[model samples]
Target: MDTLLSAPILFFMLGSIIALAGARIPFPEGFDKALAAYLLVAIGLKGGVALTTADTATVLPLLLTAGLISLLMPLLGFALLRSAVGLDRVNAAAVAAHYGSVSLVTFVTATKVLESSGVPFGGHMVAALAIMEGPAIITGLLLAGATGVTAVAAGAGGGTMSMPIDDGRDEGRDEERGGSLREAVREAAFNGSVLLLAGSLLVGLVIGKPGLEKLSGLFVAPWDGALSLFLLGMGYLATSRLREAASLSARLIAFGLVMPLLGAVIGLAAASALGLGLGDAVLMVTLCASASYIAVPAALRHALPTADPGLSLPLCLGISFPFNILVGIPLYVAMSRALLG
Candidate 1:
């Protein structure tokens, strides 16, 4: 309970309440972005340092497993959204992409919980994070193509059209379609977050523990404070968009809540099979269960423009993000302890 009431979570709540009450808190422009960059780099460097001492035999298998989970998660999400929830191809794929990708904030929060509880985890998990970032996006794009929803140039009116994949209007849009696919892949693999996180991990790996110790004053000491500020911004952004989410169908909202639970179950089974320790298992489950709000959204907006951000963004940022933080983390931790015992 004390863990639940930590400063970061409280700041998040405070931000949400203030936003809900229509109070204006002036955060400087680009402050959020800078904070995000700092957190990613710090996490990466920490993970890289940890990776130096991690048993390669164990870490290698976990990376492969995490990558497999990342690849398959979107397929499951897409199938469920299409068959059960009755979402059309484009929206379903878009939502599935978000589900397949991991949320950095959720992972950071879970790590905090693990640390508070005195459970140790491997730094290779950061590598797992970087690895898991891209596969689902590619999967979403492939699913979109399979459904025949190709990206075309905007109409002369500067308005966007939500056209089906098989629509006959795609006669001469080959160049545009190819460009979008390339762009999506680029965004998914090399976005600011992924690059910084991956780069920091490599830096940590090369520098090892001595480097981390020397730099702890900058990266380690202020981590919690940075996280609290970031989540405060997140809380404001998440709740401010609730009005848009209100338009989503009950079925979609249900999927947002339910998918995380399903993912957690799969993550637990996989981690247990791989013989992960309790703390690692909890982090794995949390990663599997959380959905991306930051990186994937930007990719989708550019790559799959016809896919409504209104539908996918709210479900991820508003519903799943909060649910995972408040409820899912504790549940996964309890499950991990029970299973590992």
Candidate 2:
């Protein structure tokens, strides 16, 4: 509870409340994105600076574990969504991919809390963040394509996927495939947020402690205050968009809440096996618990055309993201303390 009373989190709550009351968001256009970019750069720099002293030997195993966890989540989410949640396979795979991916803001918030509490964790976790994005995305696309079909209806949000018509000519198909490959490359490589995170991390790694000395005022000191404003905006965005998904089924709504806890459990258990300390274990759980609104949605917009952002975004942003921000992180930290201690 004390954790929730922090200035940044209080700002998030205030944003959600104001949004619920239907107040107009005061932040200018692109401000929210700028905040996000600021956060990624700050965290990436810190991660890089801390990583200067990290044991190279342990980094590889931790990174490999992150990848393995990312791979498992979408598969698990797909199975649950299909059998229990009753979503069609196309939507199921897309949402599953989202579950597999990490949310940068959520991870950043968790780290802030850990830092405040004086908990110790490895800097390699940020590298783990960068490493975890791609596999789940590819896995989701394959699962959708396994049906060998996609059919878009006449109107927006009309329906889910349909079988693709078989064509004799392979020429145009090759061109289309080539274009999709290029699109995939952009999503993986050129996403502005992820690129900046990686680039900033590399800069930190190169600059090391000397860089930290020069930049602490800009990046480190103001982090929480900046995050407060950022989450304030995010709270509004998440709430305002809830109306778009008001028609969602109760089971799907439940899944949005339940999936994160399920994921946190898996990630925490995995971290335990890998001998992670309490703080990193909590973060690992937080990473698995988070659903990617940015990267997966971008890829799904292209890869699974018929997959509804109306559905996926609400589930992720409206439900899971807030849940992680307000309740889930605290719960994971407590769980880590109990288990790890």
Candidate 3:
């Protein structure tokens, strides 16, 4: 409820509704890329700095649990989509990848909810975040039996990659060769968002408290504002294909909505088993509950060419992202509180 009222979510919905109503909100060129980098770096830096004082040994279980949850999530999703929903393996795997991966924006939004509630979460969660992105992607690709296809760009926050990766051949050659699993793996591993996030985390670890404090003026105070603007841009991009969501079969839409809940339940189980505190538990639940609109989609484009973007994109961005923001975050928080407090 209160989560729905926050500025970031409001801006997201405002952008969405505005776009839905057939209006345009212009942003400066490359604005989204800048915001995405800043957000990921800030998240990494904060996590890294926090890791300085915290006992690293304890963080291991949390990271391991988060990774296992991420890997397991998509397998469950694929089975449900195939058995109950009747999607083919490729599409099911594609959509499953989304369910398995975390949405940085959604995590950020959940953090805001915790902040408003005065709850504190561990920065080691960022280390968890770093490991969480790639495994689900690889799992999805493997389950789909994707050898690989053409490369596509997904920025850190902009949904575009930072640099173009040439696959040792021109586009025509790439199409003919049918890029290998290695290519897909590379995309998942070095994705702009993932690379920046993981890289920044290392940088943060190396720099520690002193470094974070020196840069606090930039990354700390103004994070929410940057996030709001990026979400607004994402709203425009998401709604660009908004009709895809509207066009989805009822079952698919239902899958989009339901998968997040199922994911969250498993997340809660993991948290309890690991004895995570309230804040980390909430984030872990949110992480599982979040479907990736970021790295998964890009990797899927290269990995599963036959997989329909229409279904996957709408489910991830349109149905799941908003549901998590408006309804899921607070619900998961309550679930955590019930379990932990």
Instruction: Give per-residue CA lDDT, model 1, range 1-341, as digits (tens).
Output: 86679888888898889899998668899999899999999999999999988998999999999888988899999999999899988779889999999999999999988888789998988898898888888888778766555664354212255555555656545555567678888998889899999999999999999989999999999999999999898888888776677888899889999999999999999889999998889999999999988788878777777787788889998888888988899999988888986
Model 3 off-target regions past 4 Å? 146-179, 239-241
- The clash numbers for all candidates, in the given order, read 2, 1, 6
Scored by Cα lDDT, where does model 1 land?
0.87
TM-score of 2: 0.93
Cα lDDT, model 3, residue 24: 85
**lDDT string, candidate 2, 1-341, tens digits:** 87798877888888888989988877788888888888989888988998999988888888999998887789989998999989887789889999999999899889989988999898889989987876788778767666545433335444455455666634554454445545654686677777888888898898998988799999988988999998888888778766665778888988999999999999889889888999889989999999998988886676567777778899899889989999999999998998898
Where is model 3 poorest over a 10-residue stretch in terms of lDDT? 155-164
Top candidate, metric TM-score: 1
TM-score of each: 0.94, 0.93, 0.88
lDDT (tens digit, per residue) of candidate 3 on 1-341: 67777888788888888888888887778878888999999888888888887775779888988888888888999999999899977678889988999999888888788888899988888888778887888788777653333334343322222122456645553453245356667888889999898888888889998888889899988988888888787776666655678988889889988999999999899989988889989999999898887788887675556667778888888788878877899899989999899
- After superposition, the stretches of candidate 2 with alpha carbons farther than 4 Å from their true spots are 151-160, 164-182
Top lDDT model: 1
TM-score for candidate 1: 0.94
Please give the RMSD to the true structure for each candidate, in Å: 2.3, 2.5, 6.4
Flag regions of model 1 displaced more than 4 Å.
Answer: 155-179
Quote the lDDT for 75 in model 3: 92
